[model samples]
Each structure stands twice: as C-alpha cells, then as structure tokens.
Target: MIPAQFDYVAPGTVADAVAALIDGGEDAKVLAGGQSLIPVLRLRLSYPSLLVDLRKIDELRGVREDGAELVIGAMTRHADVISDPLVRQHAALLAEAAATVADPAVRHRGTFGGSLAHADPAGDLPAVAVALGAQLVAEGPGGRRSIAAADFFQDYLQTALAPDEVLVEVRLPKLQGRWGVAYEKFSRTAQAWAIVGVAAAVRRDNGAIAEARIGLTNMGSTPVRAGAVEAALAGASAEAGTIAEAAAHAADGTHAPSDLSGGSDYREHLARVLTRRAVTTAAGL
Candidate 1:
C-alpha cells in the first residue's frame, strides 16, 4: 500500500512546527516516531495535506530530573527509556512497560510521546502512564499547558491533545518510599498487543498494603484506572488470598471489548487473574 501525495516538513523548532500545523489547519498531521502514523498513511486511512516532523527538534529528546519529578522529552525513544538510569531508578514501572512495547526494532524507533498521543488503549505506555499518574505537557498556539494522565485519553485512538497541540514532555512523579512495581502483560505471543495488561505500583507499610495504584490496558475504550481494585486493596493484608480477593474487582467498572484474542468476558477474567499477579508482585507479597 502507498500513501497519497502530501507535503512534508521537518521543523527544527517547536514554534515552526506549531506554525506549520496551524497553517495547514485540519488537514495537517504531526509525525513523531511514525510507528503508528506511517501505517495509517500507507493504508490510506489518513490523507493529511502536510506532515510536520519533529525528530530533529533537539529540545524534545532526553530524560532528566526536575525537582521531585522525572521529565522525559517527547521524542525520547522507548529504547532510551528502557536504558536510561534516571528513568530506571525513579520510575521502574515505565521502564518495565516500555520494554514490552512491540520488539526491539519498534522500541528503537518509537517515541514516548508518540505512543501516548496515539492513545491506543492496547498500547503498554498509556496504562502505565495512567497508573503512574503522569502529566502530559502540550505546546500549541496558546503557549503550553499540562493534562493529567487520567484525563488525557478520551477514547479509542483518541486523546485530549488539540489538533494544533504537540505533546512536548511527560512529567512523572518520583516513587517515594517502600514502593514495589510490576507490569503484567497477557498477549498471544511475544511482541503481540496485549489482550489484557495490568500495571501495578504498590506501597507497603508494616505487613499490609498501604496504597495501590492499578492501571488496565485493553479493558475499555481507553486505558483505565482500576479504582475498584485499588479501593479494595487499601490497608488489606499482603497475603495472597487477600490480594486475590481484591483483584477479583479489576473488571468491576471496565467495559472490555470482544476481539479475535478473546471475548469480553474472557478479557474480564484475565483482568482479574493478571491484576492479582501484578498487585501481588508489586506488593512484594
């Protein structure tokens, strides 16, 4: 498959890119890693009049610590995220989840912000972002603004980023104390999209679970927080039985889909089982 004719520009500056996007209007599309958009273009699913490339923008590529938060530039590669010591040390769940995105080649080419902006519910990063309560930074004609992870994804293949906006960076809160984290992904094969994925970050206090944050992938139209499971786990014993009992509520508020991998009911069941594993592992129980 081949894409239709389109004008392309690789802007060296964020302002220039935004200007191009504003000029191109509704027919313009921004190109980041191209892992998702290229496929769409080749299939002729989208025919943008202009494509704004952001790869050469130096400011949009790196990982650094800002006060208590770790700021990751939008253009940082998944491979970089996996290897960056700052990310590995401060936000282990993100690194662990990024490692599961496609295979090595995709990880090498895919950008962190690209995946989040693509807003694919099955994508590994979105659930992790939601789980970690990450903040997405977007720059548009109106300067800049931050969107909370819980409010970023609007629906399947949709996000809260406006058409004129480009996601610039992601701010992740540092894990404070006694925190254990794990990502549990269930796929038909290695590198395949997860049928059901769970990202868990649990804080332990004494011999019980102090607080737990759980994010679900492919459980709804968007990556969703497992609020029911989290509520059930608060102050619960770290025993396997207690964790398993709480994990049974993983699907309590989700609206999973029926796809080739499994039926909706099957996904709900996997959510329960995987949630237990993720929570238990993250709790170090």
Candidate 2:
C-alpha cells in the first residue's frame, strides 16, 4: 500500500521544525525514525499534508550528563540507548527495557523519543520512563516546557505533545542509593508487543524495602504506576513473601484491556505474576 502524497521537509534545527509544523498546520506530521508513522501512512491510517523530518537535526541525537541527571536526545536510537555508558550507569532499567524492544534491526532505527511520543501502552520504554519518573522536554512556537512522564502520556496512542511541539529530550534522574531495577515482560513472541509488562525499582536499607517504584505496561490507556504496590512495599521487608503480597495489588488500579492477545482478566493475572518476579528480582530477594 502506497501512502498518499505529502510535502516533506528535513529541518536542520528544532526551531525550523516547529516553523515547518506551524506552516503545515494540523495536517503536518513529524517524522522521527518513521518506525511507527510510516506504517500508519502506508496503511492510510493517517493522511497528513506534510511530513516534517527531524533526522537532519544533529543536536537531537546523543546522550549527555547534566548535573544529577542524564539527558537523552529525542532522536537517539534504541540501540544507542541500550549501549550508551551514561544510560547503562545512570538508568540501567531503561537499557534493560530497550534491549527487549523488537529486534536489532528495529532497535537501530527506532528513536527513543519517537517511541514515547507514540505513547503505546504496550511499549516497554514508556513504563520504564514512568517508573523512573523521567521528564520529557518539548519545543514549539511557545518555546520550551518540561513535562513529567506521568503527565506526558494522556491516553493510548496519545500524548501531551501538541501537534506543533517536537520532543527535544528526556531527563532521567540518576538513582542515588542502593537501588536495584528490573523490567519483566510477557509476549506471544520475541518480536511481539507485550501483553503485560512490569518495571520495578527497589531501594533497600538495612535489609528492608525503603522504597519501590513499579510501572505497568498494557494495563491501562497510559503506562500505570503501581502506586498501591509502592505504598504497600514502603518500609516493608525485602523478602519474597512480602514482595509477593505487594505484587498482589498490581491490578488494584489498572483498567486492563481485552484484545485478541488475551482477555482483561488474564492480563490482570499476568500483572500480579510478573510484578512478583520483577519486584523480587529488583529487591534482590
């Protein structure tokens, strides 16, 4: 299937990209890696009048450290994210999750920001981002603004980014204490989207669980924070039994969707099961 014809522009800078998007109006679509959008275009799911390509913007393609956080450019490839020393050291959970995204070929072409901006609930990275409390940065005619990962994703396949705003980078705070992080996912196949996934980070103090963060994938319209489980684990024992008890609350707030892959109840069950495994591993129990 051939996509409908559209005007195209490769912007050298974010400013130019915003201008191009503004000029193209609501009919303009930003092209990052084109891993997601091109397929939509080919299937005629979207018919934009213009395509604003950001590949020419070199500044939006690297990882760097800024004080206490690691700043990842929006255009950084998944493969790069997985191998970047800075990402591996400061945000290993992100690298671990990136390793499970599709295969090597897609990893080389899929952009980090593009995946988050796509906001697929089943995507591994969004759940990691939410679990890490990462910040998403965007640029538009209104200048720049920072959005928390919790607020950045609004719904399935939807984000807080305005049509004219281009995601610039993501800021992940370096884990400061004795924190162990893990991502666990269940899919039909290696390349298939996760039916249920869990991202867990646990900080242990004196053999007790001081704090925990858990994010759910494919559990709701947006990546869901397991706040109930987090609260349950706070100041609790870092033992398998305690972690399993907290994991039981994984489905407490989720609105799991029923699809061809599995039913909502089945996903909820997977959530509890995977949460136990992920949290146990993260807790080093």
Candidate 3:
C-alpha cells in the first residue's frame, strides 16, 4: 500500500526540526528510524502533511554516560546500544532488552527514543524504560522539558508528547551494587511483539530482597510498573515462593486486550507465570 502524499524535511538541527514541526502544526510527524512510522504511513494509518526526519542530527545519535546516569540520544540505534560498553556495563538490563527487540535487522534500524516516543505497549523499550526509571527529554518550541517514565505514557497508542514536541533523549539511572536484572519476553516467535513481557531489576541485600523494579509489557493500554510485586517483595527473602506470592497480582489494574495471540484470561495467566520467571531470574536465585 502506498502512503498519502506528504512533504519530507530532514533537519540537521533540533531547533530547526522543532520549528518545522510547529510550522507544520498537527500534520507533521517526526521520523526517527522509521521502523514504526513507515509501516503506519504505508498502511495509511497516519497521513502527516510533512515528515520531519532526524537521522542526520549528530547530537541525537549516540549512547553516553553522564556521571551516574546514562543518556541515550533520540536517534541512537538499538544495535549501537546493544554493543555500547557504557550501556552494557552500567545499564545491562537495557542492552538485554534491546537484544530481544525484533531481530538483528530491526535492531539495526530501531532507535531507543523512537520506540519510547512511539509508546507501543507491546514494544520492549517502553517496559524497560519504566522498569529502569528512565526520564524522557522532549524538546518543543519553548525549550526542553523532562518527563518521568511513569508520567510519559498516557494511554493506548498515546503519549504525553505535544504536537510541537520531539523527544530528544532518554535518561536512565545507573544500576550499581548487587543488582541482578533480566528481561523475559513471551512471544510466539522470534521478532514477534511480546504477548506479555516483564523487565525486572532486583537488588539483594544479604539474603533478603532489598528492592525490586518490575515493568509489564502488553498488560494494559500502556506499559505499567508492577507496584504490587515491588511493594510485596521489598525486605522479604528473595525466593521463588515469596516472589510467586507477589506475582499473583501481576495483572491487577491492567486492561489487557484480547487479540489473536491470546485472550484476556490467557494474558493475565501469562502475566502471572512470566512475572514469576522474571522476578526469579532477576533475583538470581
């Protein structure tokens, strides 16, 4: 299917891009990696009057450490993230999740900030961002503003981004100490979107679970934090039984959809089983 006709503009500067977006008004869609948008355009889901491309913006294309936090540019490729030692060493959970996003080909083209801004609940990065407590940096006509991951996602296929805004970067808190992390994605096939996925970061102090951060994918209209499990396991012994006990509430407050992959009950069950696996794996016992 061919897309509706639209003008394309590749801006070399963030300010220029933002101005273009503001000028283009509600009819402009920013293009980063184009993995998601191109398909949407091809299928005519979105018919923006103009497409703003950010690929050539040098400042928006790398992974780096800023003291205790890691900042990833909006155009940073997933493949680059999978290989960056800075990301691999300090925030390994992100790298692990990136490896599971689609296959090698898609990873080579997908961008971290792009995926997050797209706000697809089934996409791995959104859940990972929530699990890691990352902040999204969006730039608009006024200037840059930071948004917490919890506040960034609004609802089904929607985000808090304004029409004139473009996500410039993502900031992740550095993982230190005895943090054990894992991303368990439950999809029917390789490169398939997760029917229900979990990204967990668990820190152990002595034999007890010190703290845990868990994020749920495809369990609701947006990626959700597993606050029930986090609150349940804190200070408890890091064991399968304790984790499993908390895991029972995996789908609490979620609005999972019934689709070709699974029904609502099936997703809820998958949420439970996979939450246990993810928590156990992240606890490393």
Q: Estimate each model's TM-score.
A: 0.98, 0.98, 0.98
> What would the per-residue lDDT of candidate 1 be over residues 88-167, giving only the tens digit for each residue?
88999999999999999989999999999999989999999999999999999999999999999999999999889999
Selected candidate, larger TM-score, 2 vs 3: 2
- Model 3, which residues run further than 4 Å from truth? none
Instruction: Estimate, for each residue in 1-285, the C-alpha lDDT of model 2 and write its tens digit.
Output: 999999999989999999999999999989999888998999999999999999999999999999999999999999999999999888989998999998999998999999999998999999999999999999999999999999999998999999999999999999888989899999998788999999999999999999999999999999989999999999999898898899999999789999999999999999999999999999887
- Where does candidate 1 clash, by residue pair? none
> RMSD of each candidate?
0.8, 0.8, 1.0
Instruction: Write one digit per residue (lDDT tens) for candidate 3, span 46-82.
Output: 8999999998799998988898999999899999999
Residue pairs clashing, model 3: none
Please state the error at residue 267 of candidate 1 in Å.
0.6
What is the full ranking by lDDT, best candidate first? 1, 2, 3
Task: Give the worst 10-residue stretch by lDDT in candidate 2.
Answer: 29-38
Distance from true location, Cα of 179 in model 3, Å: 0.5
